[model samples]
Target: MKLLASGVFALATLMASSALAQAQAPANYGPAIPGVCVYYGAQTLAQSTVGQSVSTRMNALSQEVAGELAPYAQSIETEITALQQGRASIPPAELQSRSQAVEQRIREAQQLEQTRQNELRYTLDVQRRAIATAVDPIIVAVYQERGCGLLLDRESVYLMNPAMDITPTVIERLNVALPSLSFNRLQVPVDQQQAQ
Candidate 1:
């Protein structure tokens, strides 16, 4: 019985020691290290000179499309007016033919407008992506220059040291590296289309 009691006490002591060791061991929290810089991409883009240039170019393109569509708008209105006034005087067959022609023209104009809008949207997206890509090497250069081991997006962090914020520095670097991107429409590579 004494031996049994001694054995139980020894087992309890070993269990306690194991628990204490585990409590002292450092937790495996993730790959994040101390003193890494974080940047807000949206803020950086908005403040960058290239971003403003892109916005201005997009606005100009929109205005140009609107001006180009103005004549079609007037023609469509005139066609509608003519159809309404000639409904009684025009023979049934002639009226039907005119109606179909007017509908086809209107559809064509709408399709043309839609195509223009899509092209503009695609061009703007491509430009924005190009700007982001151009800024990537700059981001790496800045991160290395600042001696930060890690660079992360500001959105993921809830709180951080103000000194660890690198957005302003990144924006400055981007301004020097790339002042503006091409605002013109991007052409899809013909080789890529053929491959598809």
Candidate 2:
């Protein structure tokens, strides 16, 4: 009789455990609705008028930096070559002083390059932000007009229909709404800015 009672108790426990497991299971919410519109952000930005202007500014800045730093860069190269080739002939004191000067110039050049890069980055960011601010409303209007429930980045999506791509239209509208954005370099005081 005790054995039969134990068996019945085990069966009841199993049944309760099964019921608890089922209760704890998450409810099915079904599949998500797919985004209807895809936008190639990089392509759109590249094709936009503001983007082209930003590119032009960036290129100009690069050229200016190269022009300014070319002499220093050449000096460093010459110093390195001289040290390697003339180490035996150069007196110890002169060699030490020249080495120190070369090192200082290298550090200065590196710092200047970093500063220029930071300024360029800052300008680009400001320009892109302006473009985004101008384009966001247009994107929403296009999405709504097309009856798209959602918009997704084309870069992230693995597969999509060409018909659903809205990049061209977005870029077209962006150019009209924002033909150009003036990028102003932020003047952070050298003292306040971190030592590059």
Candidate 3:
């Protein structure tokens, strides 16, 4: 009798929990409407005219920095070669000093490289923000026009209908709204870069 009573209690508890779960579950709204839409923000940025322009400018800046650093790199390489070639003739103490100096120069070169990278990153971030600022209104306008209730970043979505994606439309509007951006490499202070 006790076994039967316990079985009954367990069944009742399971039924109650199932009922609660059903009550808490959200309503399934089948078929996506304009009310729910997704967009690929990164793709829109990459394909947009202003984004391409920024990319080109960033590439140019990177190439320019590389060119500036090339001479220093070549000089370091030559020094290393000379050290290796003259290793036997040089006094032990002098060799140690020369090696230490070369190491210092290498460290300085690495620091300079890191600084240039930070500057490039800062410049790119500024340009991307500028582009976002310009496109924000256009995105808002489209959202309003489409009567969107929920805007989802495509990246967050696992599986979505192709029709729900508004990326191309957003890109089209972005191209019309912002054709190009004029900017230069941002020079970040050494202190600011180091703080990060």
Task: Return the number of clashes found in candidate 1.
Answer: 0
**Per-residue lDDT of 1-196 in model 3, one digit per residue for the tens?**
2222353465467457546754665565346765888877776766789877886787778778888788889998998998999999999999899899989989999888777887887887898888889878877887778788888987687556556767788889889888888888788877877787
RMSD of each: 20.9, 20.5, 17.2
Clashing residue pairs in candidate 1 are none
How high is the CA lDDT of each candidate model? 0.73, 0.73, 0.77
Best by TM-score: 3
Backbone clashes for every candidate come to 0, 0, 0
TM for every model, in the order presented, reads 0.70, 0.72, 0.78
Off by over 4 Å in 1: 1-33, 157-161, 186-196
Question: Ranking by TM-score, best first?
Answer: 3, 2, 1
- Tens-digit lDDT string for candidate 1 (1-196): 2222353465467457546755664554345455588977866656689876776676677777788888998998898899899899999999899899989989989977766666666676788788889888888887888788878887687555556778888898888888986666444455733543
Model 2 agreement with the true structure over 28-83: per-residue lDDT tens digits: 53344455888776666666897777766666665666787889899899998999
- Candidate 1 Cα RMSD after full superposition onto the native fold (Å): 20.9
State candidate 2's TM-score: 0.72
